[model samples]
Target: MISLKPRWRSTLEKHRAKSARTERSGSVRLRIVAWTFLLTSFIITGLIFTVREILISDVGRGANSSTESEIGEFRNFAQIGVNPQTARPFETLEDMLGSYVTRQYTGYKEQVIGLTPHQIIFLEEQDHYALTTGYRLHQDQALLTGLRENPSNSGIEQTPAGPVHWGKVAVELRTDQGTTTGHLLVLEYIQPELDAVQHTVFIMIWVGVAGLAFTLLVSWLIATQITKPIRNLRQVAEHINDKNFSGRVTVKGDDDVAAMSHTFNKMLDRLEEATLTERQFMDEVSHELRTPITIVRGHLELMERTEEQEQTLLLVDDELERMGRIVSDLLTLAKSERPDFVQPHPTEVSELMISLDSKVQVFANHRWIIADIAEGEVGLDEQRITQAMLQLAANAAQYSPSGSAITIGSEFYGQGGERQLKLWVQDRGPGVSPEDASILFERFRRNNAKNPATAKQHSMGAGLGLAIVRSIAEAHGGGVWIAAPEDGPGSIFGISLPAPSPPKKTQSITATYPPQNEPEKS
Candidate 1:
């Protein structure tokens, strides 16, 4: 059982009692934009940091390579390099060092210092000061003393020129006459490269900020476009009510959003139809029963003798029975909308039809025949399908001429996935017109005369029989329709069901008519 809880009446009243308010927009589009901007900003920051680290590392490595290269070049030069001016071995180590410094090139904020046990000397800016930070390193006694004391010569150190990578080599000036020992120092300034990396990172931060702003704006626009339709739907739904189901969502394209709008529109259509149906149902019922009810009441009140009273009572009983049948059919139609309306099982179609042919004969006096039997087992609600077929048979009996052949059978029609098992009743009667046939299964439609009525008198039914048949068929995932008469002046009422898969049992097929008074159950 479903729990029944009505919506808050106070909430509804409050909505109806108030006017719409204009407030700041609390839309999801902005939130998405904000998140996108934040996430992208973080990623940009990470990249900036990563790039800075990599560049700084590369700068450091370049400094080391410059220092090592300078030292290596000096070592080789001291051993073989001669003064280009003289084209001879230098008389002293200082001359060799000075000559080498004049010819060698140095990088940015880099310098070469030649030191001896007797004197400390270096290159000045006029010659190469731009590479030396213009610092008179030879005059910095403390740094010189520290370098002399420090045995390590291949690492960065805090010299007077700031942190610099420096390598020192002790070389023997191999002359044609003798050898002179001297110390050569290569100093590479790392500050300029570090500053360059910092500058690049600073520029990246500003670019990232600008790009983040652009991304935020673009994302906001896209999200707004995506949510516009949803907002429209919500606005329409807010004012929609049971009495007014006229709100239809606007569909713009063949996309998921359009599909959603179309589906919602369809739901509203069904709701409106159901509401109108319920509203008119009682009025129609009252109209149908009014005359019979008034006649029964009049007869009961005016009866004067025992014989007259008996006749009035019989007429009253017949009216009551008719009312009962109408009520029963209405109830059946209502129940058919429920999920449990049909209990389906595997059934042998041929045998079921043979059995139905027998029961059909008992509905009315007619030449009943088994036209065909679909030879297969199928999944269906046997009782409900039988009820629908019997209703069709009854319609035939009441509409066609007495003793006119009424054929009933099941056969397969259609192809592939659209295949169906069709159960039909064909009778020779004043067949329904094409336009009238369209609505024959709707409520309160009387059939073409059943079993040929007397020329002057034709009894009209409650008109719910075909409707009940339709309900039964629909409950089993099937449908009922009238086929255009192939033969003259007759109607073919068909109940179409979806074809079922292979059955568990393979039974032999047989087609035969049942006895008029009795339908043998399979």
Candidate 2:
């Protein structure tokens, strides 16, 4: 089961809370801009369609008015040609025609005359020329009459100037001659539709320029309004470092960002409260557990000398020792969980090893294979280091086959201009599986079935040795790891501690003592 203590759970939650503060401001701003652009485009499209329809209606009215004016001019010219009051056709003036057309008129003298074969001829008011030239006039009128057969021939064409749409209307007219063929009236109407096309194009160009400028201005305003609050939030968040979590985003007006800022503040408040509560609880638990164990150890010593019942005395001693180990492990776990647990001090590697070896010999039946126990000093907490080393030794001794060799050693390796001491404890026993190795240091993890002798003999321990070992290593700004032994026989558990700047003289430490009496049976 993967369960966390209250302290660790709180730490993990705070880490998650701090992690949520690192979202990209640019991405958020871009989303805001995208939404604004879409909204504006929708609104503008509706407005443009409505405005275009109104412009088209105005253009249609203007075209119709211009067409009507041209039709009125055509009617005026037709009225001048054929008199509306007397219903008489007007004659063409003499000096108003071209010379090329006058030469064709052979009836008159060789003189330039405006009258051509298609010229107007008078009919009703014939107080005009008598039969003196009647014969010539008859021939001329007859020729002109044949020429005026097609009178509705004028039509407009499209050109570079404009597209001219023209139509002719038929009207009644009276001629001086008896119903002359040329006397048919013509009324034409022309409207140049292409002229309106130029105006529409000019209006569209100006409208587009104005619309583009307006859109840019509006977009800028909207982006500023949206991104300003987010930028302020970013600055406030950047100021949050490893130590600080009190800073909060400024709450502006009642917008979405303001609401988010309020939520974020509440979250930080909860996170801080949780962090403080967990730390306090861990300290309290550690003290609580340690006090009873110290009292129990005191009581065990008192009873050891006076108790007469061997079984009762043994049982009490075993229970006291077991409870002591559990309390020690709990304290180590609490210390390791703290962020500021490391307290580096110079300690001799040789002394640390010797102390561990002495303790292992007291409990283990296996022989120790020591190597590379360098005569050097490293910066570390001596007590914590010794505790970790002892746990590793005990673990190796517990799992190794009877009479197997267990190696406890240390070496010096340099890293980042500082030497580190790597302390290792290896056992030549049935090697652990990789799956088991991963969680071997976890609290209460037992990789193999307990030996029957061990189950009956040492029933007090709750398998917290390796877990405490790991916690001690972590507290000293180091780590614990397990791997298959180099010789391919067993498992190797190691701790890495930073070396001291100035080496200390190596000295032999005092010998470790086992319980004076035989360990009480469970």
Candidate 3:
């Protein structure tokens, strides 16, 4: 057994691991290119095969066509017609065939020959391209014997000049020398046809190889471009750590890969923002709770005598009350997350605003006024809406000057199907600051306490009021928002709630209402 030093072994292990990762990543591009080339190879091979088969079929058809053409030309000469081969009319059957064999239409593959009862005569042959053996079918005794013994109308014979297909036409003419009789033969050499097919197949093979090389190059380029995004994603993942996660994939197109990258970016943004919010929340909780504890400790530590018990108790009691309000607000927010938190029933919107106006009269000395009211029935938890509105009014009252007007209003705005309700409270105070607007509804987060105008206000409670307002609004499938008051020097805080679907516009029966004498249920 051999052992290496620790550092050397670790280095080798790391190197091997990196090599495996690289191989895995490279496989994606390799497989894509490989499959592409494989399919293209199949297509190219199929085209080459089909073309070669078609050319080979044409070889046989060409032979048949040449035989028929020669026969047709000779039949015309048997009649009183001019022989183009000799540029003269036939004097006899022998002259006609002899002149016919010399026609320009007769090529190397196609030949004309004549035969009689005694021996071969009027043999016309042309030089063949493939068979250098010259025309042997005209003189070969074996072919002649085969023709005499087995006189086929047309047949193939292997002669000295490769394979030859012979077509024979017996001729008879009424000349002065009685009825003359002889056989006219059309010989088509098959060697040239075979050579042509072979030549074509060779050319196709070279073209197919070129096409395959081109396909390979194109497939590699496409695969490399396609895998570029995946490589970027892998790089981002490798560097994604808790402390450093700013890496992002560059989106290039509106394709699926771009959508995936966009969704991933959104998820990262949410996670980072959530982490920062959680840390800020923890810090605020500590500070808010620590303040009361410090105050109580200070009071008890400096008292130092029984005579100061009443005063110290009073001071501690105030701090304890402040802590109690914070606990109550937190509990209310937690309960608002439950499904039954806001049980809505149909209530007259205008009547509910009136009820709120009466209830908020004693919350502070500010002159509370109903700015406006919308007339309709809305689905809402009457007590909850009142409480949410009262919370907004209370916040306004705490910040506004004595006897200043704190406006309360409600309105309806929507179309198609269902309408929504916007209930708001306007306060005449030092309008909202830019820095405090973003975190106004966060728990344990009050408005800019550093502002002297805000600190001077006697507002002493946890900043969970607006958070509770937001929870109530969301429970009704709505949201809360803040805006600047129109024609005013203050800010407007509002909650928008989705009203339940309205009653039908037209009715077949008369409209009716419950008698006023009947008391409503609690």
Candidate 4:
């Protein structure tokens, strides 16, 4: 015996396991076909055997009836004491017996035997006894002896040629003297019936062989049809495991297996979508991080403790902080695919507006005012929605002048079955063009056109804020959009949430803005 390496042994074991599974599947199909053929063969063979036995029984009954009729004819002749052919009375008992024997010897298929007290004579002739065997003659003698003693004899004897149905009747010869006792024997040959049964059995054996072959062929075809779909499904699953989601099994009919294939395809679609999302996220992260990393690295390469070097350090620290925010926003967007990303609860619109108004004041020296606030409980994730609204307010403040008015508002509006909760931040700033609005909410995207207010801001953020806002809105089964105000020279960025049912009680809260004190620009 040769010893194998551990790796080789593992490979061999895996191959064997796979082969075993294949064999087991084939064996299941084979068992189905084999059992079906065997059951059909058993039923057909049983029917043939039953028919053969019934035919044999019918043959036996026919032979017995013929034997009884022959015995009755012999008794009638003996009682008349006359020649059946000549229509004349006999002078002696021997003459009457001889005449009856000669009349019965017709030289046909039937045989008759006559018995007296002294001798046994075959009525046909000596040459006609060629078909009879010694065993048959001995059985006939025994039957005659029984008739002489008891006067009623009937029996079936198994001879070398086949079976023989024989019957005997005792007769009395009546004359002027007295009556003499004689015996008459009737024999029926059953070789013809036995031959017919044998021939039929022989034919049925061939028929059974043909039937078994046909049954096996049909069973194999049916089994293949049933297992073909399952085999294809297995192959498709293997392809999917290889990260090839394009392969799909053909669904030929509305069966359970077809439904399974449909479900498998749907699973592949989800996998592909997730894979694309992950790939895009990685590409965006790498591209966005590279510029800030290069800036930090360039500043660190210069080893000097000058005032300009101190400013470079500050810029590096700011870039690092911006990078941190980008990473955090990316994580939030990624988590939007998860089921627990947003935990919704009933929140009043006025409470949300008050929270936004308080948070927006710290971002800029703008005149932050609540333009409007709607009251009513709506289902929303308080923290996530607050984060998104605050980000929009910060964006508006960044693009507007230091003393420009930034208005935050919420409202409930709809008709019939459709209802919505709309929250918006409006700013008196350089408005975004319609073309730039399309890609404004995508990751790492920013408006290239410089605003004077944005240039004055010391810390320019990495452009993931709006994208995070969109992700949060979409997580709540809603959306965010940017629109230019119809009568104003600024943009209105808003988020809309579907409110299937809102609380009936309504109230309004308006915030009074403090007196604007403009700080002189440096």
Candidate 5:
């Protein structure tokens, strides 16, 4: 046998365990349904038996009444010495018993017997003479003794067929000079009554079976529907456990199961997002670090203690500074993905524009002007927004000619009951193409159509400034984009922030700038 590796063996065991759990879940549901149906069936059967006993007791009571009426008729005959039907006297004991039995007995299962202390004197029945012929009154001595000992007695006898309900009456027969005592026994074979009840019981049994079968079918269907979604959710969880988050359970009705499935799907969405972010972070780090490290390595290898050694050292320091900036920008971008990236507070828009005007003046000898300032406070991370606005200004300075007019401004625009603060830097520079505009804010991306004279004059730093700007704007729940002026041959780069709720009192400030005095050409 070939032995499996540890990881493979563990995976196989987990699969087996999961399959077993799944199977057990279905089996557990089936068992619950089956047991419930069986319990209900047994309860109904017991009720049927209870009702059967009540009906059988009623039949026994009716038989006793009939037996009592027969005994009363015989007692009247013996006391009056006359038959009420014929209005005549002089009847023997056997004759009286025969007459009374023939008159009182109405059903095939009923019998009447007359007995003395010594022998069975008379018996009458509808049919089945063997029952009377084989039943020896002397053989039931204990029963006879009980009847003689008691004036009237009633009891049940279990027979081969079923049961017999008997009522006995002891009486004394008297004529002018003689007296004789005998017993009158009335017997009812309860088999036919029991047979009727048994027939009803058989019908009830069939009904219970049908009901139980239906119950099982309905319970199985209900159980399957309830557990189906749970099974699907488990499968999806297993897929997610295997690092695949694309699987989702199908939600059915508005129930607990549906809610659970919805929550599971949402968890998968977050997991996918986090996994993608981690992979992107690693890729960006590796790609951004490689070039600077290679440049540092190349410069150090070629270093010589000559006249150019200082310049080479300066070049290495510049590359190291560039690497540091790249690392800082990457760190900022990574942190921006977190929840606490921006600490927002209310900052007046006019003050913000004035700050931007002062900050961007030192970047280049451009005719920097504050075109407009919207007078309102906006919730913003002041330092981060200033950093983003300054990056846009520096980008404008790079692309435009020296002494060119680069306008920095802020404004409020309202639409659909929502207000936003727009901070922009407009420059008369090489306008970006639509295709380039889409990707200009991504990391390590730059426009190829740079001013050749300026490109040769200044070292183009790492292309992470715009990306950092975008990250800051996104962290503030805002965004940055580039737009072309309708009439000007340049682009406007701006960031829009959601304006804060207005304060109780409002203030406005306005400033206008004159055209810059141009230096006279020599």
Candidate 6:
């Protein structure tokens, strides 16, 4: 036997397990959302970088145009060997070049100013360069190489120098400043603005990447926090959905989730109370209906002979009688649920059996093999006991094979004077399954479809006969059960009612039932 407390605990434990499962699921969803946000950040960063690259290339090209003009003037001075100090056009040119570099650098700061030293070197090395006065300006040497190697790498061709890298521009100028035509030592190169922009691009990429990672981490945590409660609510709801209404979530705070939990628990309480009330009402209603039906049946039977309509009235009376019986059985089931339903009285077992034998004989086409009715007395409600036996007899007679015997028997059961009264109705009909037997006594339950129609046609208690039988027996502190007989064909339905205290040990009178050839009992 299982303990009731453990069963209750098991139910709660299952809900906790389910809650844990939901928490895990929430964590997984949070991870997915976090990853999605992180990926989006990366994509956006890439797009920004691409757009800035294009803009820088365009700006660099414009700056390169001015730088090229300045370089031409410097070259004209160099060709004439006129010092830059005395070169008038060259002096204007030098100032223009310096201003252009400074302006370009300042403008680029608005987009990507935090270029690392390594990135600056990498950017400058993208091109080729030439030194002024045959001496390399350490700061400008890298620019010479970059201009020679990466003409178009700067996203512009405003200068003409070396490789066709984007944004690159280069210019060839005459070394003689005053000379209109002279040998122009090709000393053109890319501007430092292109190198600065590339360096800034690298620095911005790192910063954006770090920011994206931090954003993703925060987003994941937030998503997890939000969805955790939702998942808990889902799991608890599922438990209730599965009929485990005792479960409740832990209300952490006065958030929406807590409010929802409170509401859910309240709903469960109402549902439980309503369910109990409805069951009580049904029981009371079913029980009350029986008394009126019985009274109606008795009244209808009394009116049977007095009606003057003869045969038609008789048929109507029969139908009315069937309906009355069905209602009475339904009421009996209801009554069984009451605390006062059990009202046992002293009744001789022998006398009850004799009465039952005679009554059931009217419905039997085959003989009833009734065991000797012991002369002992037991406590039982006389009317209810009779009703139960009649239902059993009716069931056997209606469903059994033609002329098959129904054995009604009683025997002593239990040890140490724990007396039990056993009454069984056995028939050689198809047996019910173990699973079906569990619910055989439920109201409106039919064993199979075949008999439901027949029972309806006969108005035979609305399929509640067996249910009433079980209910009555249980009300008398007993249980009824059905199973296949081990001896061979058919089913055996039996009730084991508590025997009367101080059981009478009297002898019984056996009643033998021989085989019958007639269609009806005589």
Q: Which ten residues in a row have the lowest lDDT in candidate 2?
A: 1-10
Q: Please tell me which model should have the higher TM-score, number 2 or number 3.
A: 2
What is the TM-score of each predicted model, taking all chains together? 0.49, 0.49, 0.45, 0.48, 0.49, 0.39
Give me the runs in candidate 2 sitting further than 4 Å from their true place: 1-26, 41-61, 72-168, 171-267, 301-322, 336-340, 344-522
Tens digit of lDDT per residue, candidate 4, span 49-95? 99889888888888788878777776677667667666887665666
- Using lDDT, give the best candidate's number: 1
Weakest 10 consecutive residues of candidate 6 by summed lDDT: 1-10
Q: How does candidate 1 fare on TM-score?
A: 0.49
Give one digit per residue, the lDDT tens place, for model 1 in 1-522. 111121222222234445343224456677788789889988998999999999988988898888888888877776676777989867788888888776766645777888776766565552455344555455677887677667887777776556877788876766667777778878777877788788999999999989988888889889989888887877777757644677888888888988998898898889889876874685467556656666766766686659757877876666676775676676676566556889988888998998897898686668998877788867889998888888888777777887788888778776666778888888788877655665667788764533436332235367888887877776676766665454566777887788854435778967567865687888
The candidate with the higher TM-score, 2 or 6, is 2
Q: State the displacement of the C-alpha of residue 363, model 5, in Å, after optimal TM-score superposition.
A: 55
Candidate 4, residue 51: how far the Cα is off, in Å = 2.6
What TM-score quantifies how close candidate 4 is to the native fold? Answer: 0.48
* Candidate lDDT values, in order: 0.73, 0.57, 0.72, 0.72, 0.72, 0.59
lDDT score at residue 3, model 4, on the 0-100 scale: 14
Error of 4 at 50 (Å): 1.6
Reference-based lDDT, residue 298, model 4:
69
Q: Encode model 5's per-residue lDDT on 1-522: one tens digit a residue.
A: 111111111122345677788767656467768887878888888988897888788878877777677667667766776665778764456555555655664456666676765555444343344465454332466755665566438777775545777778776656665766777787777777878977987897888888888888888888887788887887777656422467878888888879988888898889888877785775588567867777776767686757768787777766676676667767776666666778998888899888888888897678998888888767899999998998888888888887789888887777533777778888888888756776778778876667654784236467888888888886786677676766566778887777745546778866544424655555
Q: After superposition, how far is residue 517 of candidate 5 from its true place, in Å?
A: 99
Tell me the number of clashing residue pairs for each predicted model.
Answer: 12, 6, 0, 0, 0, 42
Better of 5 and 6 by lDDT: 5
1-522: candidate 6 lDDT, tens digit per residue: 101111111122345677788666646656777677768787878776796778676755655554455445544434454334444443323332332333332221111111111222121322222222232222344544454465343433233332222232232333345322211112223345456566777777787777777777777777778768767877777766322356776667898777987787788778767756765776677566667757765776677464466776667667766766665665565566566776789988888888888888887467788854556778888888888988888887776766778878766566435778877788776666555565667677766523332354434447788877777886787777665565676677777788845844999987645634545555
